[model samples]
Target: MPVTDIITDEKNLTLTVIADFAHPVSRVWRAYADPRQLERFWGPPTYPATFTEWDHRVGGRALYHMNGPAGEKSYARWDFVEIEPERSFTVDDLFTDEHGDPAPGMPVMRMRFAFEATDQGTRMTTTSDFASLEALQTVLEMGVVEGTRLAMGQIDAVLAGLREWFAGKGTRMEVLTDTLVRVTRAIAAPRSVIWRAQTDPVLIRQWMLGPDGWSMTICEVTTEVGRSSHFGWAPDPGVEGEPFGFDDQLLFLDEPFRIVTAGRMTGVEGPTVTNDLTLTEEDGVTLLTTVMEFPDAATRDMILGTGMVDGMEMSYARLENLLLTRPVV
Candidate 1:
């Protein structure tokens, strides 16, 4: 686990938490940018959070609720003030009502999250400036300090999951004939679990998303060869892009080892892409290698420019979280 250091300044009425992650700064940044990933570790383990609103851009707002063990809920909101991608962001946070409005007499906290690249990995420093010393003390009395420590402690597990999606230090990207791209990741879970998560609709929906607030509106899978699998994503409200998805035909299935699918992006102009997914086990971990062949180099380059790689990495990180926390059936 990473060391979490907390600092309190009574004179300035502020609190700061500094922690190190074994993953890169970009990977740590996604944990805050993606709402679904944020919700997984935002609150204490006993009080998990559900984010109803999330916008990572400046001037945006986020609304969420933390559900306690007895079913009680505490609502909160963050008003984004500044945002620098993969570096830092500032927000004004406050307790809110169930209707998404700020509650009266609640302490308003100005918070900043800074991500810095380091030799060990990424160092994440979070500082919270309270309205006054009294306000800071009030939160401290409510166990905010301990709860925050517990919540931040979960990042280690989150990073562990993300590391598996990154393909480790030797991840190499080669353009074979300019039409094929191969990406590999070594996952800690067994091959069977990874296969099930890829083929089962229920499990697929858990992790196959671009970011938070986006949802899979349709996920239907047929494992048998020659059958078709359909997946669709509905973007969050006010987002610019059209709902995008894929329609895939299962061409090959080798149980918990390999699967080959020929698919096309729905509502997009592109030739069919054949995806070859292979999984192998070493010791107790599984190595997943995926090869995607596009119809042409132009099409491949065009897709690459659309930030699809970042989205895929975020999705894979979510998948790692699911595999780590979900019960095996």
Candidate 2:
């Protein structure tokens, strides 16, 4: 197991657990920040967990449940009290019922997870603060320590699994809901570098081309919210295809991590669509996920049938190749 120390302080009404991993701080933080990755090892092997709803920001709450071998389930919720990206986060953990309401007569524990760089890699320090000594004793007596130790031991596999899942996989698309779709790709670079390649006008022109016979005729991108950005593409000489473009305005921005945009085709008459993009790094590779929302199921099916994912695969492959030889831009 990666855990190096586990301490209990009755006087302070706290339990501190320290674990070490052979990965960067940012990668470990990403594992926790991403719900898909976090669900892998959040519970014991006999009781795997599944998160139904996850709101990752402060004041947000997450609802999850663990399924036992005998078809039994245990529910829990986390109220995000504070978040500091790669450094730390604090959450109030408590038991909850199916309807997302708190269970009566249960102890709520406030857990702070701190991550810092270490000589080997990263050190994770988790401190659980109890409201009273009785609370601390109650949890200890209920086997929290053993369950946590088993849970922490399983995260290494999750981290390793993530590394294997995305490598060499091209742009992947999935239908998330009746009116929503998600596209994902993993690039062999850091989040900051990927963000720059997607945003910088000069770099965008180099690899934003969707197909072999096309060129970026115009590239205008902005990080400022409410500002419109435009991108246009034209076929090379003797190449076949109509010139196309998209005009979009930033709806929300969280620099280098997430962005939301609303946009429509340049000259086509259609309903505008909303896109939410998120980036997270694991083991030096950045995973880019974009969720697109359409007005209705008809719009969703019509657009997807247009080979949108193929164009995205071509563009993303170009971006990956461009990054390999990129100078400090």
Candidate 3:
């Protein structure tokens, strides 16, 4: 993993990253501006990755979703803040519920991507700002550094592949997603392990979620509550597959108490749905209840018809079983 500068703050935490590539400014710019290109380079590329809702215009919205390892899933959104063709772009990254409302325990992530011409090609720089020191530390502890490093590497590979294609050697492929998949696991392990699995992006990549053939390129935590983090997962090179994806924002996160989130299906980008997951002790077994509330009749029908809720239940069951069978040593 490439090391990026990790800047600390007494009040505000910030992260700055810079990378140079051997590609023209226009090509580099297209990789960032085009959603289709984005799907190829972002996140865990090995997992099935898709860009469900992409509005690259300024003031527009972008959303994405992906299936995860061990029956885990993820979704997110962003609002474009500024755009300047090939020079710079900015966005306010946040976690929204299914209704597009902000959620708790997540912090606001303001990011700016700048492209500058260089002797070799173009130098791309990314700067991420957080609200406070605690938020920064929280995110660091949650595994932003490693995740970001992996994601940047994938971006580099994508650019390289694009260049090769321009040289008359690569074949272009189309990305697709037929249906949304939700995986649930039932684990008997203590809630602490479960918490680690949920909070730490590293562990999340290990087992939580990844599309069919892609890997998690980036997973960073930006806040504790009412904030949003940035996660990048993309398709692995030469892999053609789709992971069930969603576009959700975290609504509530109470540590081991419960978690609530809302978002829409990533494959179709339809109505939003809210999910409430509660972890309670039942006869020494953790009773995990995941209830998904749809915003409209259409969404409810979609959830039911797709069997995503059932999939979620099965995933939860697997998690519970894993926790129970393996003693937390």
How close is every model to the real structure, measured as TM-score? 0.51, 0.57, 0.47
The sequence of per-residue lDDT tens digits that candidate 2 reaches over residues 1-329 is 78889999998999999999988998899999988789766875445578999999999999999865334678999999999999999999999898879999888999999999999889999999999988899889988887787667658746665457677778988675577676889888889998888788988888888879998888989888879899999999999989999998888776786677888999878888887776767787788877788999999999899999999999899898888876434
What lDDT does each candidate get? Answer: 0.78, 0.84, 0.58
Model 2 lDDT-worst window of ten: 154-163
Question: lDDT: which is higher, 1 or 2?
Answer: 2
**Which candidate's lDDT is highest?**
2
Q: What is the lDDT of candidate 3?
A: 0.58
Worst 10 residues of 1 by lDDT: 165-174
lDDT of 3 by residue, 1-329 (tens): 22235444445467777777888889899888777667654654223235678888888988765433222445567789999999999988766564445667777788898999989888877888888777667767866665565455546535655323223312121111122222223344556666665667665555433334556565665335445444545677888854444445676676774566665645564676655554433223343444455555565555567644444444344444455565443
Instruction: Give one clash count per candidate, in the order shown.
Output: 0, 0, 67
Per-residue alpha-carbon lDDT of candidate 1 for residues 103-184, written as tens digits (9 for 90 to 100)? 9988999999999999989998999999889889988888887778657755664556644534453334445446767666
Question: Which regions of candidate 1 are displaced past 4 Å?
Answer: 162-329
Relative to the true structure, candidate 3 reaches a TM of: 0.47
